[model samples]
Target chain A: MTDQPWIAVDAMGGDEGLEVMLAGVARARRRFEGLHFYLVGDEARIRAGLHSHPNLSANSEIVHAPEVVGSSEKPSQAIRRSKVTSMGIAIDLVKQGRAAAMVSSGNTGALMAMAKLSLRMLPGIDRPALAAPLPTLGDNDVVMLDLGANTEVDARNLVQFAVMGAAYARVILDLDRPRVALLNIGSEDQKGTDWIREAAAELRAATHLPLDFTGFVEGDKLARGHVDVIVCDGFAGNIALKTAEGTARFVGDLLKRAFTSSVRSKLGFLISRPATQLLRDHLDPNNHNGAVFLGLKGIVMKSHGGANELGVATAIANAAKMARADLTRRIAEDLGLEHVA
Target chain B: MTDQPWIAVDAMGGDEGLEVMLAGVARARRRFEGLHFYLVGDEARIRAGLHSHPNLSANSEIVHAPEVVGSSEKPSQAIRRSKVTSMGIAIDLVKQGRAAAMVSSGNTGALMAMAKLSLRMLPGIDRPALAAPLPTLGDNDVVMLDLGANTEVDARNLVQFAVMGAAYARVILDLDRPRVALLNIGSEDQKGTDWIREAAAELRAATHLPLDFTGFVEGDKLARGHVDVIVCDGFAGNIALKTAEGTARFVGDLLKRAFTSSVRSKLGFLISRPATQLLRDHLDPNNHNGAVFLGLKGIVMKSHGGANELGVATAIANAAKMARADLTRRIAEDLGLEHVA
Candidate 1:
């Protein structure tokens, strides 16, 4: 029985099963020495996979679960199987104080549903927002929130998201005051919906919060690195985030086509491989895999279903970092301050 | 006086004023022989600028305007000065049938306001949509619509956008039955708002339209080339378009930095300049510059304010193409068919 913080892992959640998940845990364990894992899944399969990762097996505890949540299963259906399913039990471990956080690569709708139902929201937060760090041209990656959590949000929901997002950014980016802005079509005061305008007015009035309200930012300026935290309703945020990803991949595909156009170009690509490799590393989705569900009572990190071992490990590391930083407590304190203000 | 189609040019609208706009028109005129221009701006400056382009000066006639709409001016304010301003007069030329189309690189809000006020919406259309062609991995560019034209739209508006967007795509992409889709957070039927779901239901029911409704698409797949037209509310469309542009530019910047990082990379860049130039041309916004205000009684094109000569010419060319294809009539006919269905 170690006193080290434990992160519950839904071992059977992702597209790749026990072997890849265990390998990812092993890799994460090497990077984070003080973290232990609650490997919740089929005990027999997990135990068999553990033979390959001796170091991880020594630090992990297996809990058997008979059912696995289907990737296409509805959240409502998945929630009914909370007691028997691996994903549900892993989340339960966090609720029971056996684990500090939970990470899953299962159906996003299911995870969000279960987490929201089981953990519930923080005192000031009406809803939990999905926050992720996107690569930017500045010194730090920008934190964006509500990436499909609440498709529709009012002014109050947006203000709470801002407080929660700013607190999360402060812990993750190590900044005292993160610059937050609403995502809109234009930067003008009269831009966007009444909800966005109202939220901006509230944020502007919140001078005592640990964030600098930078008014509004458009989608094209998202990766320009002008603002630290970009907030919007889930519909817009999800659209912007996914569009950026698609564009990045589109450019990469074009580069490949360009480099392979001729033999001379191929030679140039070879010579420029080191430099291009650096750019590739910067743009790789695996390097920035984890997306945290902010404003929840307990931490829940989502790993991309198609992510490889490195991506999964990155997600685990992110969960451990948030737990170590006491992000939930920090957010609660921020919300309290906001309430007082 | 000539029988050639005349495109009204807002000579004083863009950032560079007369020089860039005239140069762009001259370039476009060289490519399109059967085109004339109504150069609307300060008569003295346009005459002086056109002296350098003898060919354009021979084909174009100057329509003097006393005022230039300020880039930061509100739409309501700009709409009042429609009788005197360059952008307003250019739109007026279209409304009066003196010009086949109008091209401006001025304030987007001002242009949209003036065009809508002057030209009015086509029959069976409630609102005009801003449609633009985006580069894709496929042989043809994909058309996206309602890019900041209407911030909030109902199911009827979305369905209207789909019909108009498909008509525009058929003209622009030269396709028989352009595959159309509604942009949402997810492809699942139950994923988005009620409006989106209702719009999807309507589109799925309409089989008599010229477009092939392919169901829903996400932001990340906007440029994937599977669908010909993507329809969304102006807010989401604008965010997706701008984010795509920003990400492309971000990647380009990173590529530049990568190529200049090492001595070997610098040499490689010199050798691969041709290939990279090809990529640059493909990604350049100028190549895809023109955005048309669809469902309008007259053709109106909006150019990027900061676009160079090539960009403005592309906008002019796009306007000319739309005018020649009789895009407005096509959309009107599509809408009538939709109404009947």
Candidate 2:
């Protein structure tokens, strides 16, 4: 493994300001020995945050990007004109091999666009998909993909997604012959759209691939951890992902309100503190941290836009792990993209 | 209000057997005054269960249907051949005005197919849709439609769903101008498919409709109760509905595991039973018991195939409320379908 420890972070991204990003970087650096950071954003704002942490400031480098890509800006426009934006420069560092990988908590569309445009897709890859780790009942978490990358796709694209996702499962989660499935309306072969039916056939026919190609999986099977990699078009995937997140929040809030409703419940909650902590850790979005933009030639992880210090720190750690694992190279080799011109 | 209190129920439908159905019907009769039921199913099984429940036997009548439709059977095939199937006869009773409404806990596709073939769509209604009440954060619930009725729909069908959903919301939730929203990938007007875009434009231009047409609501807003009526194609809506249900179960199960991980935690959980019960009641799928097949000429409520006594009782109550409010007639009038012929 490479000894390089610095992570290029787009400090100007996310809904929060430089304070949270810088704090996250500081926290990560403090926790991990010899960890360094390249904070890409406005020099003035970053410096203001670093002033409180002398040790973090000593270990960190600030790269000034004159423009910041706003979350509301169109992705294509942001990619074209905002060359000096923090996110753009952060991806540039990764592309130029100055940084191992890049992490951004910005507009997901823009981040995906910039990362793809800057590093380019791996050989034989038609599109780059996003995969996030979802907590499951099983020993390991599940990997769900194409959360919001390509809205409309054909059978061939879905097959390719399965290939890439299988490679991801192997490299990221260390699963052998990862059980891969296509997200459909039902579990049967002929349940979904014609495209899905055709794709299911294609997935079944791929004998040479090193994947346990399971049959179709419905949305209900997602949290059940039946399949390792769940693939679908970005539209359905986005809905499922956001819905899960929202439901988790809703249920968590409901439990909190329930606990505080009465004195007896409050005492019970206090007694269950250890269990509650474990539960919170398991459901915490920060633990999942990063969603990798797969099929790209380089590593780029997108943190949730509303992520806090802990979330950002976890994202930085995720990017570092991907870099050490050389995830892109492994994906290329596994997908036979290495032979492609 | 019509004093005729009998509801024609399909006993041979659902995953559960005739005993469960009889139990549910018995519970419904005991809960509601002046309630009568026409249980249509296999003669022997229905009578066997009714024989045990003497009180239910007095108020209930069994319509002997020799054949039963399997949950996996094709809807068209089931409807074409099994004329005397429990579900078909239940719809027929409603068609002949023997019962105010029909309730089934069967294959949704079969129910919709039989209802469409027997009851026919209301005038000016292109297609019938399924509307299910989703519990929201607010005091009132949101009615989401096209749950799994029409797999493919045109812009006009969505417009019709909006009208029907708004009418149901008005009568059920008692909202004057029920806020209607087209479920889209994004809140923007041009975000989704061509059909959704066209539907949004038409809904925006509509002046005679009795609704506060919200432009769009994303999947996350469904739980937040941001809109009263959420409209979408059957495929996406089904995926969303199933996903929410699965996630709710996943979270609930996860909490249970967390609480039972240790003896101390179990004790804490025991003490907090009241709060847990409250949360469970709030998130119970049975609480929102029935999915109404809207835009049909008469009322039809589809209960969960796995629902127990409480769920069936709730479905009966929901059907009774719809019948008393004359929900189908109101929807027809609002859509100007009553005079279309």
Candidate 3:
């Protein structure tokens, strides 16, 4: 791992086209010294955009990809046309070992489909999981996994998600060993489905793994940050993630209505604006901009499709960090798939 | 269906014991005129507590019971000793037609078990579902069902939940035909399991029901208020409810920390204390107090275990309203089980 290890970027993907993508790449390069980028998209458009940022242009090269994947495209359809798509070629760079990692703010399903096809699954891994950092009351954010990768998971899949999540937490959060828990309806011993209970049994007896397997955690304890890694099937995990987001928005709306109800409160709001600003920044989802696809052959991070330059830059920084840490290899080692490498 | 119908209360259940329970009953008696209470617990202790409120004593009668179910006790274990426990007897009062409805702040599983066993399921209903009103940005609260009554539910169970939830909304929220939606991880038709997809298809093609099936809603759109009835299996529904609760608490805690940070902010907080208080009250779980067990032969509401006097009173008020509206009978009519009744 070097400071200049190449990180692939899907220039034609994301909400704001090449403009925001290049700006984010420039911002990331400014922060991480000697950073190199492979911009995969239309070379003419990328070169035109890069002309505004001389430093980023000097350290980057463009790989032209004429086609692009639409957000509405089916995964099966996207896979057939991956060879010509910007997101597809970027993922190909990782598979070909020309780039250490690939980052996209494009069509999520398409990105997942192309990455899975090109990189393939690691040894002993039936499926890869989508993981992201969620804000918590504790000092460090907790990592939650299988957000929407695999809808239905068996006990073995849940156990694999635990291993992948723990390894990712160790690399990103810099923890030696992390406490892992299964997300269930209730914290009781017999609360959830047979698969969850079976997974709990397996994790409890898994003496070879370097994880502290706490039995079960209710959904309300998710943001309390008592555990480092929380694992669940994509269906439940995805629902939990969105429910939290909606609740945050609901609270914010209520606070605003309360603050603006009277002139006295308005004056008070101005006085306490700075304090509320701090809270606002912390609660903002943009601060947590990166969600990586774990258990792939190479690192692939998904930026928010509608993320701004700062959000995109955060994803790039996380991608660069994961590539530098050799995250995929670490996951392989944790799964006892080191021999496969 | 009179306002003075006897409503059973579990006097010995919940964290605060007999004192809070009686106080809440007293408060409800004051709020709603001609409300009679069937207190199920130890008669001596109840009489001692009732001495503090002559008004409540005049309107209440005690049903003695010596047994109590521990919160840690499993449903199977609780069912074995159902005849003696306060919660079990309270439910029995409803089944025996001695009380119009039952309200408890006790072991939820035990209460569900006892109620289901005593009352039995309504005709055309496979199993009972737990439902409660959740706050929303719209004018009225949304009704969500299967909050953990059954661990898993099939397509038919989901449809039945919709019918019951819509009926509850009609009585509680006073809507003619509420908009119902299935809670899924994604709004896309292809996104969930075969069970949910099948459920969605059935609801979509259902022309006989009074409900307007609005297809699918993601977890984040829950509080948007656009959909009136949100249906899911117990597992997913439970997660959504708890996740929303946790997120609200997390946000509130962060806001408090922000308000207390600086001298300027402290002065501003004093000026806007009323406004923030309004926000806190709105966010409090006490205001949204009662969670009803639907599909039962009779009405049974579950109050928050650690709720304060005000919280308990809210649950009691809701119980009185549901009892007067004849919620169980309305659900029976909706399920075409009125003939059986």
Report lDDT (Cα) of residue A341, candidate 1: 83
Residue pair clashes in candidate 1: none
Candidate 1, B7-39: lDDT as tens digits: 999999978778999999999999999999999
Better of 1 and 2 by TM-score: 1
lDDT (Cα, tens digit) per residue for candidate 1, span A104-195: 98888899899999999889788889999999999999999989888999999999999999999999999999999999999999999999
Question: Each model's TM-score?
Answer: 0.99, 0.95, 0.97
**Model 3 chain A: lowest-lDDT 10 consecutive positions:** A332-341
lDDT of 1 at A184: 95
Please identify which of the two predictions, 2 or 3, would achieve the higher TM-score against the true structure.
3
- After superposition, the stretches of candidate 3 with alpha carbons farther than 4 Å from their true spots are A337-341, B337-341
Which candidate ranks first by TM-score, i.e. highest? 1
lDDT of 2 by residue, B63-142 (tens): 88878778888888888855768888889989988888989898887888889988998888888899989987878898
The numbered model that scores best in DockQ is 1
TM-score of chain A of each: 0.98, 0.94, 0.97
Highest-scoring model, lDDT = 1
Structural RMSD, model 1? 1.4
Per-candidate DockQ vs. reference? 0.88, 0.67, 0.81
